[model samples]
Target: MSCPHVTAIAAYVKSFHPDWSPAAIKSSIMTTAMPMNNSNQVLKDFAYGAGHVDPLKAINPGLILDLSEDDYVNLLCDIGYETPTVRKISGDNSTCPSLSARSLLKDINYPSIIYQIQLMQPFVANFTRTVTNVGFANSTYKASVMKGSNININVVPQVLSFRSLGEKQSISVNIARGKFSEPTVISSPLIWTDGEHSMRIPIIIDVTQT
Candidate 1:
């Protein structure tokens, strides 16, 4: 049987430039990272560590996540980098016109970044949320669209809508529910578009989901 433990490590370094792909990520891991063998120990430590914070519920029954990767962890509350949610419409939802999510990101100083999915990938220690953003262009300028998520998901447009324009796509990450076992992998297929001089944003998400 396959193990249920999952660990993910991410690095936004100069070598990666602005984009990445799954095949490339796989190759990278094989060359640079070691395959995890002892999953239970990590999971045990994470739960104990988090439980220490809340003494009252040290043994609270919940999902356990044990993730260890060479790159720095993307644990919440510890990251200087973030995708914060802002209220774009204070008025009524009916009165507030629906704006593209990309519009929100273009206003900031973020660069062109893309992420890929890793199928059957498992991870630990996480939360869940949904967010939206909006932006306006100057005279004769084009406005961008934007949305937000901790991780990007790949599914049919019916389930996971890929990002377009200047907006980021939304993902339903199990990272929040805290599912940890033995090498939990979340799988994300590669996504791309084609055209003359078309910009192919390669996103590599090497995860296992089981």
Candidate 2:
């Protein structure tokens, strides 16, 4: 059942652009999904990962956070993988860097952000994302944040301009703790809109004692 569904979407995308990776196809499907059910009720937590697939919107998601094999290798290295093990998995001559040099798991080029923050510490988490424009050229998108909790969220380069199709731009999200007294998970969405299209990314911040 799911295989045919995925294949249809993949085929539609491939018909237009044959260069998209499996990861990109998956991201597009997830990020553009509808978060509501037939009754117009919002989906539950982690339901379908990013809710039910929206195949039409997935086709033209405006912007995509593409990933490569190196990104997966970095994800493994971030979780304390040794050089030899990482290199073995990658089947390459790559070397894992020191802990300080390793990329943070939250920094992965994913469609959504998931992070944990210490409840009592003065903490700030930064996530840098690159988006490839798939929408109209000469478009400008503005950033907006929707909150379900008390974290302070800011997006640098608040406005993005695309000169041509497939143009890539970098955006950074800076999240700082503020009045997060209760130990709970706070979820929000960082949205970028260009009047016609919107790129929405869900952000879940886990507040706990570290």
Candidate 3:
């Protein structure tokens, strides 16, 4: 059986990027990891969660979904923690932000998209992401998706243009869930390519039959 305790990749990445946060480190490992099987085919999520970790590619992940401390705090509170409970967990007396200020889990800055399917009902989720340019300047990246199941996936601003290094761009992933006859899961890739480097993010959708 494959071990679920996989921290070597994250630890290795942290050694080089000590300043990166936990989320960034995880994103690097997952976004750059291999999703292919020994036969060179894309493996399902049940087989591999973002596939095998690649140390080299992870070090220079073209883009990262950066999150701040406040983002996490808000995430916890949004999930139904009162102000005092949040303060206790954060080891600080910070008060919870107003409901209007809280961001949903789907809005968290994650490199990949994950959604819980609503049985017998179609749903839509929009995920916002920002990527900093670590590659060459004056480059444009085009977005593409490997179709999976019957979901309708679209990325706004299909093309990203960067004039200088370290420039950040925003991307919105709009996923419209499709009805499934049975409980199942589907996987796909949301890729951004500059005709040279490809930043691939594995997208997983879990469906349940009601």
Report the number of the highest-TM-score candidate: 3
Which whole-number lDDT from 0 to 100 does residue 208 have in model 2?
76
Against the unseen true structure, what C-alpha lDDT does each candidate score? 0.24, 0.78, 0.79
Q: Give the TM-scores of the predictions, in the order they appear.
A: 0.19, 0.82, 0.85
lDDT of 3 by residue, 65-126 (tens): 67887988988888898888988888888777888877878878877787878678778888
Q: What's model 1's TM-score?
A: 0.19
lDDT of 2 by residue, 102-195 (tens): 6678888988988877766667889998888888988999998976457789999999999998899999999887646656766677888898
* Model 3 TM: 0.85
For model 3, the run of ten residues with the poorest summed lDDT:
37-46
Task: Give the better candidate number (1 or 3) by TM-score.
Answer: 3
Model 2 local distance difference test score: 0.78
C-alpha RMSD values across all candidates:
18.7, 3.2, 3.1
For model 2 the local lDDT of residue 15 reads 67
